[model samples]
Target: MKPGALALVTGANRGIGLETARQLAQRGAVVLLGSRDAVRGEAAARSLDPDGARILPVALDVTDTRSVAALAKRLERDHGRLDVLVNNAGVFVGATAADTTAEVTRDILAVNVVGAVAVMHAMLPLLRRSSAPRVVNVSSTTASFGLTSSGADLAGDASVRLAYTASKAALNMLTVQYDRAFRQDPDLAHIKINSASPGWTATGMNGFRAPRTVREGARAVVTLATLPDEGPSGGFFDEHGQLVW
Candidate 1:
């Protein structure tokens, strides 16, 4: 990552988001830890960097357009441009497809799909100011149809999370669309957009049942967020390499 780069990670109060922010800070980027709750966000930021050296807590509720706009405005005022954005804020509500309802699906989409798009739209102007900007959408392997249908162990178990899986699949498409649109535009070609799967981390979203640690889950996100100008875009990747989209 570039020194003094300005980065933002949403839902950074805990779990993979928090770890991503920490890693970015360690790489010399001034990271904005975004959370829906101001207090928790501040606390999380302090925990990562007690001296307030690299982390700044910001109240950002991606689902709310007003909140998203407010954060954009603040970023423009405080920092001329944003170099990286990690759309890590997501929710997994329903346990199984059999028990999932329309409302639950809507709620999941609102945060995982719609909310992520909102944040990206609002942050585009700021990102445009940077020489090289990157966006990493925290996706999941559960979104992969190839794996799900291949009778893989993880996919077989994730099949029960209908709402989460569908939402992430939508997010993956959103990443592709954004990358395509940016690449087609001469002025925006430098912007890289990609989706990442953290490989079933033990986060609150999963009741802490997942075996992977937060650091392990955050590696892929940080890698995409800090990609070079020539890095691949419109791709779904994990820590190892590109994943089957």
Candidate 2:
């Protein structure tokens, strides 16, 4: 992206989020590492940059409206604008569709779907201030209806967790709708919005079962986050290429 661009990444205490933040910082962006816990967030930021040169940790519990608002306010007061937002914070509770309870589904949606949207909503004003802004929603292949229906590995696995799968599907739609809205608004047309699937990375969310490393999984996210002004929006993509919704 632009030199010294401001970027915020959620769930940055570990896994793909952490890697994404690291990559962004390496590319010269001032990165904000957001975590639900302040202590963990600060530690993660320190681990990435002991001198606190480029990365800053911020306490952000996406499920709480007040916490999201507080983060937005802090960003505005400190930095004035946000150039990139990586909506990577998510939760997974493994249970088959048949065994998944309403409560479990609700909990998953609270983080994976509602929490993502809430953060985006609160950060839009700050994003608009940037000459080129981007919002990358970290999604999954399981979220793709085409892949799931076509029996694509874990995405079509009969034992996949319904709550997690459904929440990601919702997140994909959220990305599409937000992108469309921004594109139609002349004043905000410069904003780029896209959903990215990290391709089954070995993150804590999956109990470290996936084959891909966090660095590999974070590639698509960083690509979308740092997309040029001419890049596509309202699209779903993976490491290989674009995906069907």
Candidate 3:
């Protein structure tokens, strides 16, 4: 058996997701890089972990059901179960993207919201078999009600992209609902599920203009992914600590 747990991270070909995968692998987990492009996935996996500590490249397009199911089956056969799942894939309909048509909105939601749910559904059984199962959602601070409220801090910030924010807000609720469901069931309550904000980082999503390095932004995700069995669930946190929902 491996000395540490096993983990899978979606959208790990670059940016925060790749950095998080790297950090998790460094911590001893057998990390799988889930990417849409097989070549990019394998390349990223190698770049982050040249010596290969248990890291593998799994060709995964979260929006594709068959691919998701196939990855689940492969993991079941290879690892028996998955210990961690990081829902890090997201789409940011930027400032100019506000003019996006309903079709565009649906497309974004398909990958960011529906696709994530599908992956979660597919991975649940494998996770159930693990003693310490964890689902860490890579969310954004813009999803915070506290931040978006009119009188609260960061209100009126033009950086808030409507379509993207709404998608993530819905995702946060999804996290809460899943946590409640897990808690209600004795067999699954042991699973820790939480949403985390990676903060503003220089990634392709933001055009790599943000100040924080990918390493700095990936910390909260790595922390939540490797949480102790007793760690909090259904909470939202940033790098410093928990955030006000």
Candidate 4:
């Protein structure tokens, strides 16, 4: 909540990301709206906090390296440090197992998995500068192997998607890897690294057939982003509580 405690959220132009930005700004944190389109990002920021100086827009396309680096440099010059990072930029092409192709899976992973890591790699330096840094990767229940293994495809009545689920599964592993990578440093150890399943949230993605709203989805992400000094890392959670890997 400090003046310099900035939080960057990718794909923040709408859906859960936008709601998360709004909530963060409401809590006195400077929210950086990282959207692929500059104009849209600016619009989202303004909508979140019109008169407040806490909302700013950063043009970022998670899948593009040039945009990622540019955003990192921009943030380094402006804030020098970042308190929270929400890698919320992702896509879901309805590719079911029966009809899903390798190309479709690759494309989905490119954005949902690789894109998230690229963003993290770009902003890690800034995050390290913070006293209480946090990383929250917005994931889904479909990513849960246990859930999927049990054939609990929550998308039952909705459009069944394979590429999307696989991408999130890869993302969960990425989250765990990041957590393990920084486990040695005591200072960095306090930096909570976790993934969360926002349930079936109604967002711009998934055609909005999801039962939950973006506001509800934003809760778990925001909570993980602003964890206390003593908080769990290398875990997946939801609005209800901890979820099995």
TM-score of 3: 0.94
- Model-by-model lDDT, in order? 0.92, 0.92, 0.87, 0.85
Ten contiguous residues with the weakest lDDT in model 1 = 151-160
RMSD of each: 1.1, 1.2, 2.1, 1.7
lDDT of 3: 0.87
Query: Stretches of candidate 3 above 4 Å error?
Result: 95-98, 151-160
On residues 1-245, what C-alpha lDDT tens digit does candidate 1 reach at each position? 68999999999999999999999999999999999999999999999899898999999999999999999999899887999999999988856767888888989899999999999999999999999899999999988888878876772256468888899999999998998899888878889999999998998877788889999999999999999877999999999999987
Q: lDDT of candidate 2?
A: 0.92
Which pairs of residues have clashing backbones in candidate 1?
none
TM-score, per-candidate, Cα-based: 0.97, 0.97, 0.94, 0.94
Model 3 over residues 1-245: C-alpha lDDT tens digits?
Answer: 13478899999999999999988988889999999999999999999778776678889999999999999999889889889999998887664454756876787788888988999999999999988898998888888888678445542244547778778888899999999999999878889999998888888987787888999999999999989877899999998999877
Query: What is the model-wide C-alpha lDDT for candidate 4?
Result: 0.85
lDDT of 2 by residue, 113-207 (tens): 99998999899999999999999999988888998898777633448667787899999999988988997998788999999999878878777
Sort every candidate by lDDT, greatest first: 2, 1, 3, 4
Error of 2 at 133 (Å): 0.2
Write out the backbone clash pairs for model 2. Answer: none
Give candidate 4's root-mean-square deviation (CA, Å).
Answer: 1.7
